[model samples]
Each structure stands twice: as C-alpha cells, then as structure tokens.
Target: MATYISKNLISGEEIVLTAKNHWLNFFSKDWLAYCLSSNEYVITNKRIVVKEGIISRRIVEINLSKIESVTVNQGVFGRLLGCGSFTIIGSGGTRETFRNIDNPVKIKRAFQELVS
Candidate 1:
C-alpha cells in the first residue's frame, strides 16, 4: 500500500523511498499493541521521516545533512525473513531506530545516496 505524506513537503522535496512497518509488528496478541505499532517511514530528497503513535501523534524528522551514519541490525530471523531494524545517528549524537522494517539494506543505501 502507498503511504502519502500528510504534511506539505518542500517545493523540491520528493519522496525517494517508502517503507511500512514489518509484519512482525502485527504479531502481538494484543490488538492495541498491534494497532499502535503500525507506522510508516518516508525518505525524501531532504529528510527521513517516521510517523508513529497511538492516541497522541509523534513525528520524527531527520535532515539528511545531519545524518552521520545509518546502521541495519539483522538477526538470524531477520535475515531469514529479509527484515531488520535500522538505526540512524545524527550529527549531534542524536539517534533514532525503526524496528522491523523491510529491505533495510536498500533503505540504508538510499540514505547514503541521498546524503552524499
């Protein structure tokens, strides 16, 4: 399914990549947890954004220029299913992680290509 950005983007900021929360997010027996864990990651020309929350809303936006590194953590199960968690380190030592996302390698590559 295609996820569209809810907020207005910059004049030239175009979406380069998009990822939905992994199927594992829905594995919880608790329906509330499953619903709350649903999220989307969008990579644009200028930034990476994560939209998440349950009742109240939370949006995390990281400028591409401030990203110092991107790392993907793939465990045995993750590798087997081709899904992993991604960590992004920013210039000020700030960090964020997106768990159980798809095609982590491609996501990391997209970040590197956009930042450079």
Candidate 2:
C-alpha cells in the first residue's frame, strides 16, 4: 500500500535508492528503505538533462515498479500550451517530480507497458 523508491544498479541487479532530501545534489538515506522494484524506466538524455533542467549530480534513472502513479499536471497556463509536469509516487520511501515536460502520453504508455 505504499509508493516511491530509489535504487542503484549493481552487477546486473538494482540496489535501493536512498537520499537525505536535505540539500539537492547531496544524498544519504533519509528514510528507512528505498527501491525501484519494477523494470520499466525512461532513458532520454536530452529530456532529463537539458529540457528538464536536471543536473548530472545523479544519473538519469527511475524505477517503474516503484512508481505509484503518473500524473500530467498542467497549470492554468500550461494547460493552454499543452506542456506541464510529471508527478511520480514511489513505494513508501521515495518520490520524483519533473516539470515542463513534453510527450507525456508516451511516458504514460511506457508505464502501461511495464504493468501489462
């Protein structure tokens, strides 16, 4: 009954993802546990790097199973432009939020593929 988790890949297996959530860029185990349990993920360099404005401080990775739900949030203005945000809920331990994204439909489809 929980959502959100983080993890790392090791020897063809994935380890849990942990963070302090104290200062961006810096990371430590803030919670008790974290894991991206599913095998579904997105791998778009330009998307998370340039378009998303995320730094290389961490790798471009996310666990599809850890995701609770995918939401496309369009602000009043964003709804007009058709560009918006992505809200992902992981197990009980982790959460990821992305903004000003494009082609959310494709992303949703990817998640569907993982579950189906």
Best by lDDT: 1
lDDT of each: 0.80, 0.40
Candidate RMSDs in order: 2.6, 12.7
Question: Candidate 2: which stretches are off by over 4 Å?
Answer: 1-56
Q: Write the per-residue lDDT of candidate 1 for residues 5-115, one digit (tens) a residue.
A: 645577889989988766776775434545654466888999998877666566889989888999999999999988998999999899998787877888999998987
Q: Can you give the lDDT of residue 29 in candidate 1?
A: 49
- Candidate 2 residue-wise lDDT, 1-116, digit = tens: 32121232334443222122112112223221112221123432112111112222233344555567767676776556555656666678555766544445455555565555
Summing lDDT over every window of 10 consecutive residues in candidate 2, give the lowest-scoring window. 45-54
Steric clash count of candidate 2: 7
Clashing residue pairs in candidate 2 are 3-90, 3-91, 4-90, 4-91, 6-17, 7-16, 7-17
So what's the TM-score on candidate 2? 0.46
